[model samples]
Target chain A: MPLYLIGLGLTPDSISLKAINIIKNCSKVFLDAYTSILVSYEEMTKLMTEVLNRNDLIQADRTLVERDAGQILNPAKDSDVAFLVVGDALCATTHSDLYLRAVQEGIQVKVLHNASIINAVAGTGLEIYKFGRTISVPFFEEKWKPVSFITKTIENFQMGMHSLLLMDIKTKELDWKLYMRGIERYQNPRYMSCAVCCQQFVDVLNTDNDADLSVETKQDFEEIRIHAAKAGFSVDSKCVACMRVGTDDQKFIYCSIGEMAKLTEHMGAPLHSLVVLGNIVSDMEQEMLNLWKL
Target chain B: MPLYLIGLGLTPDSISLKAINIIKNCSKVFLDAYTSILVSYEEMTKLMTEVLNRNDLIQADRTLVERDAGQILNPAKDSDVAFLVVGDALCATTHSDLYLRAVQEGIQVKVLHNASIINAVAGTGLEIYKFGRTISVPFFEEKWKPVSFITKTIENFQMGMHSLLLMDIKTKELDWKLYMRGIERYQNPRYMSCAVCCQQFVDVLNTDNDADLSVETKQDFEEIRIHAAKAGFSVDSKCVACMRVGTDDQKFIYCSIGEMAKLTEHMGAPLHSLVVLGNIVSDMEQEMLNLWKL
Candidate 1:
């Protein structure tokens, strides 16, 4: 008996035959429902049940996977179990933790890798080799606005390396207000758009407040802006906005960060990403960017 | 009719249902024979033909794909055609060029992405977000040794970012001896081993030869050595050697560069990669690396 950790890639039919076969033979199938979503649970359940000709797929939310992981690994002791994740099995740290847990328990662990946004970012025609650290931009709420990703983008640009910004996605989130009133309700899914992300970048760059700083010390806004200018990144810096990459209707928009912040009216869909260009864009890359210029 | 660019991932069964559906309806299917190899031509042909129940897969060598790409694009003008790549479709510049060509010729193009080494490196347990620019280690011939990858590795270390080294792979390579004698014969495939790559790193770092450099000015050996040392990368720097990733028999070995260089006797199969550890390995990353440490 083994625990199969399989990646479903990023599309409805991106599931591989190898993964499908493993799911078919597994005594239990658990889809990780918290980290990311490929499709609606109803749609995925319908597809899997139709293909495997079995209806045992379980939706494992954060509570089930994080708080009670025993439910996922316990069954594998006696029979094969499948833990399905969106994108590659090891992309998220949670899955890696689960893998370690399975290994610690002396259970056979098999990982089936698949496409993830980490690799799919190559579709932007920017050389994958030129990319530096990947950063994520979270949605800015009234009270909690963070700008660590902006700092990361500047650091990457200073090194003449491209920065890949993965926009935030909130799925099956708790309605805090309702929860506080002793009523439990889930909020609608929210995905950060490039427009909002760029606006945050501009706002953060213009601000003097250090309330969001998690580090021990903070610097003046003037010093930070000077460093950013030296790194060749400003609100006017060129960046690429990607929407639903790898799918049929996938779209890309190339413009300055400032222009993208103003183009909020055109921002569309979930699962968006942005790439802040570095100081060393080659001629070929520049030509490719021209194809998607706004 | 759209020209489908499908990624087969890194395994025989890694092909997705969406890619299969697209290939099944294509008037012609081409397996890119130059960039990389997933399995042998015989093995992949058997799998695709058996699964799709068709035998129209054309092996598109460099000559056909680079020189005569019109053949790949023209058919899509009238009917759907598929150009299959081993990893993700846009990971290589050649495929992106083909895509631009198709768009320029008014042919509709669709890209079906899949797992690539770029993302599969996540399996090593290093945070993908911490990776810097990717570098490649070329097979060092007696007269043509290059060390640019070493410079890139040191630069990545300077930024406290991990460096992903894609080992050199030679498939269907021209035998220069025969080609010079007016013969068109290709030598057997060659994949650079992590052991060889580590040894090259040591050799390049120890020597002061400027002959391998293509830069405008030559650098002194001592100057390069000092920079590398300051960047926290030496022959004894910690690194990870990955062999045949995304496969069932995939193996990882974490050790010093010098140690890996000496452990050449155990270097296994094709499709190898190396990751030079940076200065910023987190506690979790260190624990993960310990799992595979030698």
Candidate 2:
């Protein structure tokens, strides 16, 4: 099997004409749904439908993926397979595993890289190398909650760097009928929302001695800019709220956490992530971030 | 005037067709040259020629961006300005100031996000968020040598995390020619190659106790998987040498730093960066990271 691992970056519109071309040319596809999900699920589906003119492309969720990537590995052993990954083909190492598995199975594997949030955060005006550590703000468990991510964020800011806070995922696509990693009934109905993310952030600061290194106050939240980006690569429903990103309708701005807390109206759908910007007032590229406003 | 910020990830061709369409629509560009540089001088120029069909886009080296941006704010305020930034648009907060300045001048700004090595490192089989304070390795100098970045890397790994070792860029573009920061030029015009990056890692470790953390031995060198991510963005050229990343291009193997140090031939062009993999390998992903033909 000649399997091609293709990536679909941040937003639905983020994919290139080239990727669309490759998808069309592939014989068959096996989309991995575990490592990451597309920014625009429906939009990407629509796009693939339009491009492939077929809807039979296999949507390989975690179970199928974790179990038998061998199908992708030895596709031509029966049929040729084109493995599709969300975001970039290699952004998450799991896709590489699938590729290697295919190679081990003597399946001819190829990779087609696309834009992922790994590089998309550049839009937030933060230096990629300067970013301390990236931590996802997953939906917390009530009692056994883990918010150590806050400590990392504070550390990043103190070092004069920006932090990218990826929100968690919540979907209903699991095959509940199947018996697997005890995950048959493993549907967590909620994804991490910016509201939760901010509330937790403030909670962390309020509990610490971080006045100089904190935005603990509600007033400071007013100065915070929180952007919630959707997951699929074909999504246009991306909601850009928080005044800090721009004057009015600008591409990027620095909004206070308070403003971000009230952005539920702007943040719609799944696959949402946040960018909590700090001290970005010096980039000469700022002249470019806040554009397209009336 | 309006300014647009665009990121070109790590691959030379890692940009989106949408981004290219947007770039072509721009009249002039002011690129920020400090955070990261495009592929090589030749590739960057060629990219411009192929995309915009023009070569007049102003390469705003740090000095030019810092100084000339003022003009972009004032007299040239009426022109549609595009500030092409490397990596993701918001990955570096340094560019936000430029956006604010444009806003102050009543100009508009837009950001076109692209992939960067920040997330691309995930392709190396390391957990995206399991990384610690990111730092750069400068081309070693005779007297002004420094290796503080090593301290941070060690701290992160000690805490069970990874480290992204960025390579430095020494550019001499039109912007550099006109607005020189006059930093010392490299004696050998050498970039911090993988071998040098590893050697430096050894140099830093040697100063302290790396006996347990010691990867000084050639055997240790053989165990490391150094990534040489070349040609970022849409058409990125990636060759995972020490290991076969996702696919097998056996042509890229050996013990040049465990075959991870295939610097000269693999690093498609200049402006490439190397990431030293740490201990926190995602076991699920390691299945692939291990296949890296070491």
> Pick by TM-score: which candidate is best?
1
- Model 1 chain A: weakest 10-residue lDDT segment is A213-222
Query: Could you tell me the TM-score of chain B in model 2?
Result: 0.66
**Residue B294 in model 1: shift from native, Å?**
3.5
Overall lDDT per candidate, in order of appearance: 0.82, 0.53
Q: On a 0 to 100 scale, what is the lDDT of residue A165 in model 2?
A: 76
Task: Count residue pairs with overlapping backbones in model 2.
Answer: 85
Across A183-287, the per-residue lDDT of candidate 2 in tens digits comes to 566455566666566656554334342343333343333223121111111111112222212112223324455555555555444445565543333444343
Worst 10 residues of 2 chain A by lDDT: A228-237
Over B1-294, each residue of candidate 2 has an lDDT whose tens digit, in order, gives: 467666665444656655676667666655565654444445666777876687875666767666767855654366666666665666644466676667677776676665555665555555676776566777655434465555555555555666666676554424444346765443334455555655555443333334434234433323331211111101011123222222122122223233343345553334444544444556665565555544
Give the per-residue lDDT digits (tens) of candidate 1, residues B1-294.
998888888887899988887777889988888754665567678888789778767889888987899999999999999988888877854376787888899998787888888888888888888888899888887556666788888887877889999988777789999999999999998888999899888776765565666443234345667788777678889999998888888999999998999987776777789999887888778877888887
**Residue by residue across A84-124, what tens digits does model 1's lDDT show?**
88888877543667777877998888778888888887777
